[model samples]
Target: MSGPRIDPSLYRERDVVPIRRALLSVSDKTGLLELGRALADAGVEIVSTGSTAAQLLEAGVPVTEVAAVTGFPESLDGRVKTLHPSVHGGLLADLRLEDHERQLDDLGIRPFELAIVNLYPFAQTVAAGAPAGEVIEQIDIGGPAMVRAAAKNHANVAIVVSPDGYGEIRDALASGGTTLEQRRRLAAAAFAHTAAYDRQVADWMAGETGQADRVLRVEATLSAPLRYGENSHQRAALYTFAEGRGIAQAEQLSGKEMSYNNYVDADAAVRAAYDFERPAVAIIKHANPCGIAVASAKAVDPIASAHIRAHECDPVSAFGGVIAANRTVTLGMAEQVADVFTEVLVAPDFEDDALAVLRRKKNLRILRLPADYRREIREFRQISGGVLLQTADSFDQGVNSAQSDSSAWRLVSGEEVDAATRADLEFAWRACRAVKSNAILLADAGASVGVGMGQVNRVDSCHLAVNRAGARAQGAVAASDAFFPFADGLDVLLQAGVRAVVQPGGSVRDDEVIEAARRAGVPMYFTGERHFYH
Candidate 1:
């Protein structure tokens, strides 16, 4: 037995009466009181323990406390309440097996037909960074016991783990009783519920005790089933892990079905938009920022700005891209967005007038993410056989710790860079490391003037970056996503009159490349972080 089996055959026999009691206990009492009332009304006794019993009594439902049903008083801070044979026998007894039936009859044991349970919110508690005592208290004990017992004997009993299943339970009872299929589904829910809780506990203990070698184990629940996966041929779903809520859980204001890529890049773009304090637009293509601009939304609000600024960032790449903003969209924003094409737009809000204009483009997708969207991020990546999960890659770029101050190399030989200029250079470097392979970025002031990505070679990227600038590349600082790897890229920038360069200098022929920069009298600095996207 690999723990507990949840096979369909295990629940094949559902005709038995169960003398069959239904045990109910849950911390999330969303539908519990109603379920308790229904079970009791059906002449199926309701056995509960501690708080559940108190809640049932308060709700005017007649519930037999475990102590009353088992003829044993609660003990040891109530830990010993439901572990007795009176409870287990009812849960574990096999009604169909003759010898077991005879033994149960002789021993005066009555089997339970249903176990309605929802575990303590251990995941939420741990995620809240709760104190040790409180976290320990939240770990469920008897609930898992009853659920396992019921699930183990699913052929005789039905288990309901989610409050959402309360309706199905009533419908089943109304139509005589639950079918074997229903029992199996409930069993699977019971098992999955317990497993997720257990992983949370294990992860908590590992982190709390400072276990360096321990790996973080995670389990998240499916909040919604996606229409399809990366392709329409595959099935997909969205699993939530941000303390049970996040932008992923945000309601859609207006949109068609969000495709797999839309959700992936929309989340990425939204988080990136919140990185800076200033009002900005982040246009993301294929999960990477293609154009990021700090601009006035034509007016004060983002929706209006979208009208005027949406396509202004980069009209071509903005097509089918995802847009995110930290501020509300204004009418000017709406007008800006109205001109260009995009697949999705997300923000803290959209003004009524701006939204009205946006709605004209009926097929465009829009989502109002939670007000506190940046608090936590659950990043996920696909693997061949499983998945790789982590906290969203940390957004802190350590802007303060820059190599600009030191004379590691010369930016302008004798011309000392001022504090303001150094800040610009540092910010440009961050934008550089964030771009795609063969990537080159031209930064003037705080915004990108030109960006070249996914080029064949470093020289090609340099030409494309400067060419995109048209006339702006002159005197603009340039940054590359990786080491030059050769001097041809540098020669092209010198020809374009780019004054400064930033890149990761880790090539075997780095000295040669550095010598080339020295010859061109152009200052080139190396950022250790190499960003590569495939």
Candidate 2:
């Protein structure tokens, strides 16, 4: 992870000795019986732990208990099982070093040629929300120690850390055992396993305490080496964060590789969908929302507008947009968007019926993220020799926690909103809050009619919204991710006939903007926080 440490040149032509003696201990019993039997059949002696030995015996696999090999039974609540010199000597002895061999012979210690081990389920238990006591109980001390020792002597000892390696183990044994190259690769895997395991433990503790010093998990996926970064001559590669929960983790369905901007905006659209209660879709272009709509949970083609609302917002810029949905994607929806020159369709899952239709558009990017997944994307961007690393606002806890506090976006209209209108306002607020900064949104009932985002200034964004809404901007509810910087921004809204406005009321010129709204006779509400995505 810290880049490759060992040089590839050093591993070439390496000599390896077959493993004739191995120490095997694992709390996870998966494939243990088969592995022990295979090693025994290959003429390798097996040293195991308490229940592991019992299980191997029951399975008719020849094995020696750790006590038999180390002359030390597990003590101190099973902590002292493999800490003795006998166990350590077997793992650490260098077969090629005469001094090490002489010392081992003088002490009558056996040099183990292989160590097969997998640690206790620390990450799995922690992830299951176990109590700290149980999690601590699952941490393996002796297992990691043996793994490290065996990997250190990988020059002579082969270390296996994963059950998936059983096939390679058998192959090695059948093919006159493993060569040194295989041992090195196995050792690399062993160390990576331990490193990942340790990082997991550290991250779980960090998350429990709300500590940020050590990342809960590093977010990274490798990208191909580029001919050049920024400039065509610079070397560059792309990477995706491997952590966080969300649709981003879905296996690739099909399409060209995602570009840097595609991923950034797709993340925005998906996170926005998580905020809405009902099924919703947001079509994003260039990191900003272009078309957004919501409907009944059972509504088909949720983004499709009714005849009256079809002309409410311009769909010209909606071309090549990334659309994300909260519920399963269906055929009706696929057909509607399939006509548009869309780039990607991301959803919780895609129905086979929908997939059957969407696949014909071979170039359309399709992604299926996990249901109820949350992604907190964080990464670095560089400009002019300066690098910036920032945490991405991928999920809104405020949106998710609205039952206890819709305090973030309170509608304060002079004309009281009836229940139906209030519900629509909340829906509109949720949809609008997810657009990019310098944003303005216009919605009729529960569906968006106009959206403008990421402008150089809020007033220009207002123009973009009003222009897009055209005549339909009249009498539509308006929402802003941030408050107007001055009265002129609202003047643009009033000229466009916006009836109601929602904004995070924290601008220094709020009084000027409010006075303009009050004069325009437009009701305005203030939600105390800005939902800005940059």
Candidate 3:
């Protein structure tokens, strides 16, 4: 395919253009007073609309209202305020065209050299759980129109769409006006801002109307640059969505900057910690759960016990891993972790004594997740050519039912699970879901004994789990994200002395697998729901 031919004459290259007049209208009003003062100091005439005009007037800045400039009043509840030909003609006129210049003069429309606008908070309204009517009303039509017109005529007009852009615009105007390059950059930013706004409205409406094909769109802002990606050779950065919660929202208390792998592993660890109601801890390495444990009724110190037990699951792998706890970190718990070389620790809060001890390790990263933080509603994955979107794996979904003795799970073979074993099986299943595909998780009491993740075959996962557990596998319970393909995989766990098993049984050889468990006198339960994290 041939590339589109470029027309050199359509483009004008210049060093700078002086600004004589500007139109300012904004919903956020951020930096408006400062920007107005700066424009006035530069001898630039300012025109504004509605509350913006009133605000500038109160601030003692001379300004003209949109209605005064257009000779038309706002109608349809202020929707038609800036849609006049006078406003658009000034914005669209081409300086190079004599006919366009003459037309502006013939209509007596004052050309605006600059436009400052930011659309209404439509996405914020939706996120606040506003009613559909209120959300629809928040969508700004005139703002986007003005932004597009100003952006399209970048050769003559400059556009400002964000409060962060105010400094550069003020600097340019104060230093003998803006350059062609600066105007082009600002125009591109304006277009992108409007485009994202439109996408948010479309997605919100599609969701309301039950549209079948929901095109995944994410408006994520860059949070920070990471030292490296999965490998030192690759490049990566972090992006935050909505109010920028989750991993990006976590406040770093003390330590070296978090790397790409640290964020990945920390995210997984925190998710696992959130699954349990009691005092729990999860240790993760390479985006896989190496250890997980919940406190039992008999434990005197729940937090410390949970941390110690979790660290005991795979002590070697836990050396440089991330640790996440649901409860606050106390001095005693900090003392336990202080013995090992941990990379990161995340929790709701940390006591002063705990911080004093943990901060001693200068390179250990510590993060505190906000108390009101909620998981995102949708999950996204990038594929080869496109993207995949689905509802997030919520804690109340299929997995949580088994914890409450819901009928969604059925005992398939051998014998009914006792109360203690059932609790372990549920805990194992929760941890298993956090692991990668082809996962097998083993648990005893309230702690994960072993975990096998990202294996190609079910049998290999079983073997990996058994090897990691060692003697701990004897009489331990296990959870599988999916059904075993054949009797061979079940036989491996049975021979390893896994007393009880939980799986989502929907394989072609389900009968054979059940029979193998029955013959081995191993109890098995079917959750009727698969959790494949790939």
Q: 288-366 in candidate 2: lDDT tens per residue?
A: 7776666644444554432113222457777777878877777777777677787887888887978888888888888
Relative to the unseen true structure, what is the Cα RMSD of model 2?
A: 4.8
On residues 269-365, what C-alpha lDDT tens digit does candidate 1 reach at each position? 7765665566767788887676665554244553344323434435677788888877888777777777778889888888998889888888889
Error of 3 at 331 (Å): 2.6
- Ranking, TM-score, top scorer first: 3, 2, 1
**Model 1 TM-score (2 dp):** 0.82
Candidate 2: TM-score? 0.85
lDDT of 2 at 191: 88
Task: Give one digit per residue, the lDDT tens place, for model 3 in 453-507.
Answer: 8999989999999999999999999999888999888888999999999999999
List the candidates' TM-scores in order. Answer: 0.82, 0.85, 0.86
Name the TM-score of candidate 3: 0.86
For model 2, how many clashes? 7
Instruction: Note the residue pairs that clash in candidate 3.
Output: none
Worst 10 residues of 1 by lDDT: 405-414
Among these predictions, the greatest lDDT belongs to: 3
lDDT of each: 0.73, 0.74, 0.88
